[model samples]
Target: MSNQHRMHGVFAVPTTPYNADGTQNLEQLAAGVEHALDTGIGGILCLGATGEALALSRDERESQVRAVVEAAAGRAPVVVGCMAYAPAEMSELIAEAAALGADAAMITPPFYGGLPPEAAIAALRIVMAASELPVMVYNNPHSTGTDLQPSHLVELLDTGSFWSVKETSGAATRVRELRAALGDEVEVFIGADGIALEGFSQGASGWVAASAWLLPEQCQRLWDLSRDGRWGEAIELWKGLGAALGQIEDNPAFISLIKAALSRRGAEQGPVRPPLPSVDTESVDALLSTIDGIEGRALHV
Candidate 1:
C-alpha cells in the first residue's frame, strides 16, 4: 500500500524498549513491530509520544526509527513520529525518518510551555516545508498544553503537506470538524484512547493508540464495531473503556504502567527509561481490577 493514502484501522505506537544502559533494544523493537503487525494493526509509528520520543536523544530517535523501518520490511507502513522543539530540529528528525525509509513522518506541536495557535501554524509550516515526505500532525493538547484548533487546523490542512492528524486531547468533535473541512482530503486519527471508539465512529479514519501497544485486537475490535454501524455496542464499550484506558496516564508512573501492561500480555521486556518508575504490584492489581470492570473483562492479564 502506498504511504500517501490515509493510514487506516488501529495504528499502534509501540514503545521503544531500552536496555539498562539506555540504548534502544533494536531486537525487541523489531519483535514489537512484528507482533503489532501480526496482531492485525494498521501502521506502526515508532518513536511517538508513547514511545517516549521526547526523552530520547536525536541519535536514539533515529535508531528507533531505523529499527522499525527495517523490521516492518514492507509488511505495513512505518511512520516515524518526528517529535522535536524547533523547526530546525523537526527538519533533522523528519529527514532522518524519510532517510530511514519510513512511509511517513509525524509531528507534535511544540511540547512543554505550549505555543500560540498562530505560532503553532507557523512552526508546522516550517516543519512541513523541510520535508518532501507526507506529514502527520500529532495533537495532544493535554501534554503539549497547546492545541490545534479545528479552524486553525483547517488552515494547516490547507497546506496539503499534512496528510493526517492523531487527535489525542479528547476533542472528539474535531474529527467531525476536520471531516467537514477537509472532506476526505486528509486523514484524521483518533489519538485519545478514551475516545478512540467514538473517534472512529465519527468519520475519523483510524486511531493511533498507546493502549493499542498491548491490546491490539481489543482496539481493533472497537474499530470494527464503529465501522460496522454497531453504535449500541460501540457506545457501551466506549463508556466503560474510557475509565480504564484513562488510568494508564494518570498514575504517577504512567509510562512504566504502560510497559508493565504490555509485559503482562506477553510483550515483556519493555522498561520505560527512568526517572519513570515501573508499575508496582499494587498498581498492577489495581489495573487488573479496572480491566475487570470492562464489558467483556476478558483482558489477558
Candidate 2:
C-alpha cells in the first residue's frame, strides 16, 4: 500500500540445485544466491516457481529459504515463496520463513481444481495471520487455476493485514487495471518474465523474473530503461534474452530448464526434482544455442 516496503525492482527467482541423487544441493544453491546478489539486482527469491518450490518438501523448502537468507547476508532482501495446499501448512512455511530471518514472503493461493474467491482469501488470510512479516500476494492463474482477483486483493490491502503482491497473471491490461484501481494503495510486482516490459510500462514496481538466473544485468537494464523512459533499449535487451525465458516460462517444470541452461554456463546445479524430470539433451542443446545467440548479440553491440 503506502509503498513502505514495496519490493520494487529486479527480483530474481533463482533455480534450486539438487545433487545427482536428487538431494538438495545447499552449496550450489548458496553459490547461485551469491551470483544473484553480485548481479546487483534488487532481490533473490529462493524456493520460488523457478526454484522448484512445489517440487520441494516442506522441510526442504524451509532449508532452502534459510540457505538463501544466510547467503544474502543482508545484501538484498530474500523473498521466499511459501506455497502449500492447506492453510495450516502455508502458515507453517511462513513462520519458518520469518524465523529464518526472511525479509518478506511471496505467497500464492493453493492450487487445485479451482478455488472460489472466498477460499483464496482464506488461504492468504491464514498466511497473514501467522507472521508479522510482510506478505506479498503472488497471483498466477496459469499455475493456481484460481485467483484472488484485483478487487479481492484490493480489499485485503485495505484491511492492512496483507502487504504486497507479485502479479504473474501475464496480462498487461490487468497490470494497468490494478495500478489504476489501487495505484496509491497497494504494492504491485510483475511476475512473468516474458511480458516484463509491458507490465512495467503499466505501473508495476518490479519483476520476479525467471531469466534472472542468467540475465540479471539485462533485467536491471530493462528496469532502469523503463524508469528513464527508454523502452526501446529495454525491449532490445528483453528480445535478446527471449530464449532463456522460453526454456522456463513455457516449460512443464521451470526449474529443470533453468538448471540445464546454468549447466551450459558451467554452474551445473544438477537435475530438477522428481515428477519434473531433467531437461533432455536436445532441449539443453537448443538452450545453449540460444544463450550463444544472446552472447553473440552482446559481442556485436
Candidate 3:
C-alpha cells in the first residue's frame, strides 16, 4: 500500500524515560513528547535503538507507544520502531504499534543473524507484507549489521511495501545515491545526527534525529533552514550544534548522555535502564556545555 502521508522535518527518536523503581514513567514520557510537539518537532518515534527497545519488555513497549501517541494527540505523526528478530516478530510489533495509533512503522532487517542482502530483503519483505501500517525501512548498519544499499532500497521500494527509508549508514553520499536512484518515489530521512547538514545538502528529505529529543526548537529550525534552501544559515547553525550532534552519534553511552541532558533541563528522565550504564559525569558536563554553548548562538536565519 502506498503511504498517503509524506513524512518530512525533524522526527524525534525519544528515549524511553523510566522511573527509579524501574517502571515505565508514562507521565514523564508523555510530558517530554508534549514538549517536543510544542517546540515544533515534526514527528515522534518510540522504541528506537536510542529508546533501548532491545532492552524493554513487550508490555513496556506497548505502554511507551500508547503514551507517546496519546501525548502527540494528532498534532504530529508518530512512528514506532518495529525491528525484531524475524518477520513474525516484526509483524507483531507493527500490529501492536498500529493498534496503539502510530502513523507508521520503522523496520529493519533482523540484526542478530548478520544476514546477507538477499536474505535480509526477503525477511523485510515478509514483515512489510504483514504490516497494516505504512513502513519506513530503517537502515542502521552499526546496530543492525546488514547494510541496506541504495540498490537494495530501490528494489524494496519498487515492491510498494516501503514509503520511506531512514538511511543511517553514516555516509552522506548514500543520500545522494538514494536520491539519484529513486528520485522522489520515496522519502529519505537522514538517520545519523552528525552528518545531518551534509545529508540535507545531498537531498535528504527529513532527519530522524535523536538530538531533537533535547533540542527540538533548534532541530526544527535547522530543518526549516534546509527546507527553505538557506544553506549558509543552516551550515552556521549546524556548526554550533555539531559538537552535541557528534557526541549523540559517536559516544558509546549516548542514551545515558541524552537522559542526563533531559534531566539537567528539568525533565524527569530517570537513569537509563541497566546493562546500559549511566553517562560519566565528565561526559554529561561536556554535553551540557556544548548544548549551552549552542543555545547561546542566535539562529541567524
Candidate 4:
C-alpha cells in the first residue's frame, strides 16, 4: 500500500500480551489483532509505547511483531515500532519487522544519551538506508530526551527519508506547523490521544492511539467524524470518550490499565511484564467504570 493510504485513519497501538509466566502470548496477540481490525481501524502498530516494546527482549519483540502480522492477514496494514538507541540495533529491528511482512516501521530519536539533531538525523539515515519499508519518525520528546524540532523534521523529510511522523510533542500547534512546513510530503500522525481532535483539526494525517486498543470503535468513530468535517459530532463523541482517554493520559500504568480493561471485556490480554506493575484494584475499577460510562454497558469486570 502507498504511504499515504497506510498512514491515514485510526492506527491502534496494541499492548504486547504476556502470560503469567512472562512468556509471549501469541494467542492473545492474535485475538487483539482481530479485535482491532473488527473495529475498522486502518492499521495496527505493534511493539509501540503501548506495546511496551522497550521492555521486551529481542526474541519476544520479534514474536509479537510476527504474531500481529500473521493474525492481521492483510486486513489492515501493520507498522512495527523499531525503537532503539543506536542505528545498527534499529536497523536490525526494522529488518525483522520487514521480514515479518510489516508494511512500515516507526522509530523514535535515540535515547539514553540523547543525540543532537544532526546526529539523530544521521542515525535515522542509516536505518532508512537499511530497509525498504516506509518509515514513520516518532517524536516523543518526553521519553527520548531529544526532540526533533520542526526545522529538523523538515530536513529529514526533505531527504525523502521518512513517510510520516508520529508527533507526541503534545502540541497540536506542532501538527499545524508540520503541515504548513512540509504540506503533504510527510504525513503527521498525532501520538497523544488527549489532543487527537485538536491535532485532526490542525490537519494531522491520523492518530496513533493507545486508547484505541480497547475502545477501537469509539476511537474510529471520532476519527471518521473529524476526517469528514463533522466537527460537531466529532467533538461530542470525543467528549463522551474523554473520561476513558483521560485514564490513559493520566496513568503511568496505562499499559496495565489497557490490558485490564480488555480482560474485563473477556479477552485473555494477560498481565503486564514486571518493572511495570499491574494496575491496583482501585485503578482497575476506575478504568472499568470509565469504560462503562462511555460504552454504556456493564463490562464483565
Candidates ranked by lDDT = 3, 4, 1, 2
Off by over 4 Å in 4: 1-6, 297-301
- TM-score order of candidates, top first: 3, 4, 2, 1
lDDT of 1 by residue, 164-265 (tens): 878876754788887887667678888777777667768898888877776676677778888898888777766656676778756868667877866676
Cα lDDT of model 4 overall? 0.82
lDDT of each: 0.76, 0.76, 0.85, 0.82
CA lDDT for candidate 3: 0.85
Report the number of the highest-lDDT candidate: 3
What lDDT tens digits, residue by residue, belong to model 4 across residues 178-286? 8888678678899988888899999998899988988999999898988899999887777768778887788888888888878888886787877777787788898
Q: Residue-wise lDDT of candidate 2 within 1-301, one digit each (tens)?
A: 3455666788887777778887888988888888877868888877774356777777887788888889999989888777888878777777888899998877787876478777788667766766567877888787788766677776666445466678877664888888776665566778887777888888877788778877777677778888888878777877867656776577765567777778778887887667776667787677778778877888888
For residue 180, what is the lDDT in candidate 4? 84
| Model 2 regions lying over 4 Å from their true place | 1-4, 49-51
My TM-score estimates for the predictions, one after another, are 0.88, 0.92, 0.96, 0.93
**Residue 54 lDDT in candidate 2:** 77
Clashes of each: 0, 1, 0, 0
**Which stretches in model 3 have alpha-carbon errors above 4 Å?**
1-3, 299-301
